[model samples]
Target: MEIRDAVPSDWPQIWPFLRDIVRAGETYTWARDETEESARAIWMAEALPNRTLVAVDGDTVLGTAKMGPNHRGPAAHIANASFMVAPQHSGKGVGRALGEYVLDQARADGFRAMQFNAVVETNTQAVKLWQSLGFEIVATLPEGFNHATKGYVGLHIMFRPL
Candidate 1:
């Protein structure tokens, strides 16, 4: 699979996967009822300067990632990112490839480290993937995420120095 910069046109292909993931209310912190227009705005913002990407194989989009300053003003040196893979492509290394690409982009952009502000504890696949990529769970917010199925689950703050 190859990783590339995402253009505005790519959103048409990305929206379905993004909508499915967010609607599931299982992993991402985005509003479950988010509209396609709003999601498009957010993803496009990520495509600017220090932001997003898409993992593709020729014409097919396998996954996507967005990277940016982890915080504002004084804390901007650190980076942050999010990822999503097409449900059909899960377990095929799309997430891993996207994670690695985002990290490399962050480092190249001069970030000191990368932080995931809210990783749902029950999402074992993501937790494992981040840990495998060298991120450590710095803290876990008690009963942070109200998962649709798991009820309230902890949200982990993961970090890795670049």
Candidate 2:
């Protein structure tokens, strides 16, 4: 699969899986009823230094990722990113490729570090992936995430120097 910057045309393919993932309320912190318009606005970043990318095989979109500054102004040197893979593509290295790509992209963008502000602890697969990619759990807020099936769980703040 090839990873490339996403285009508006890709949204038609992206929204279905993105909607399913967000509505599942299992991992992401987004509102369970996230609207298509709002999601598009957020995911299709057009401003400078912010990017949205897709992993595809032929015409099929396997996964996506968005990356930008963790915060503005003085904190802008740190990068932040989010990822989503179609359920059908999970366990097939789609996420790993996106993670590696995002990390390299962040470094190339001159970020000093990468920080994930809210990672649901119950999402063990993701926790393992990030850890394997050299990110550390810098902090965990007690009962910070209300997982769909696991009730309240810790929310981790993961960090790694780029």
Candidate 3:
């Protein structure tokens, strides 16, 4: 498998999985009914420093990630990122590879740290993954998310130095 910057031609492969994941409302904070245009606008890298990446085995896109500043101006030194692996590809190390690459990329971009502002607490896999990657739960907003099936759940703010 190869991990590299994503291009427009990759979107057709990415959208199907991305749409399914978002509509599941299991991990991401995006609207369950997120439109294709809106999702594309957010997932595709637009300018310097920000990036969208893909993990592919030949022509098959196994997963994707987006990384950039967690905030603007004074807080821009901190990076933020999101990841999604196709359900069929989960457990094959795609997410971990993406995480590691994003960390390296963020450091290369001069980021001091990385922060995840709203990690759904019930997503134990992600919680553990981030923790294993040296991130710590800085705070948890009690009952911050209204999960589709689990109802109210905490949203954890995770952080780690680049």
Runs off by more than 4 Å, candidate 2: none
Worst 10 residues of 3 by lDDT: 42-51
Model 1 lDDT, residue 21, Cα:
92
Q: Name the better of 1 and 2 by lDDT.
A: 2
Per-residue lDDT for 1-162 in model 2, tens only? Answer: 999999999999999999999988888899999999999999998976999999999999999999999899999999999999999999999999999999999999899999999999989999999999999999999999888888889999999998
Measured by lDDT, the strongest candidate is: 3
Which of the two candidates, 2 or 3, achieves a greater lDDT against the reference? Answer: 3
Model 1 clash pairs are 46-52
**Candidate 1 lDDT over residue span 103-153, tens digit each:** 888889988999999999999999999999999999999999999898999
Find the 10 residues in a row with the least total lDDT in model 2.
Answer: 144-153
Per-residue error for 123 in candidate 1, Å, reads 0.4
Give the per-residue lDDT of model 3 (tens digit) for 1-162.
899999999999999999999999888899999999999999999877889999999999999999999999999999999999999999999999999999999999999999999999999999999999999999999999989999999999999997
Error of 2 at 13 (Å): 1.2
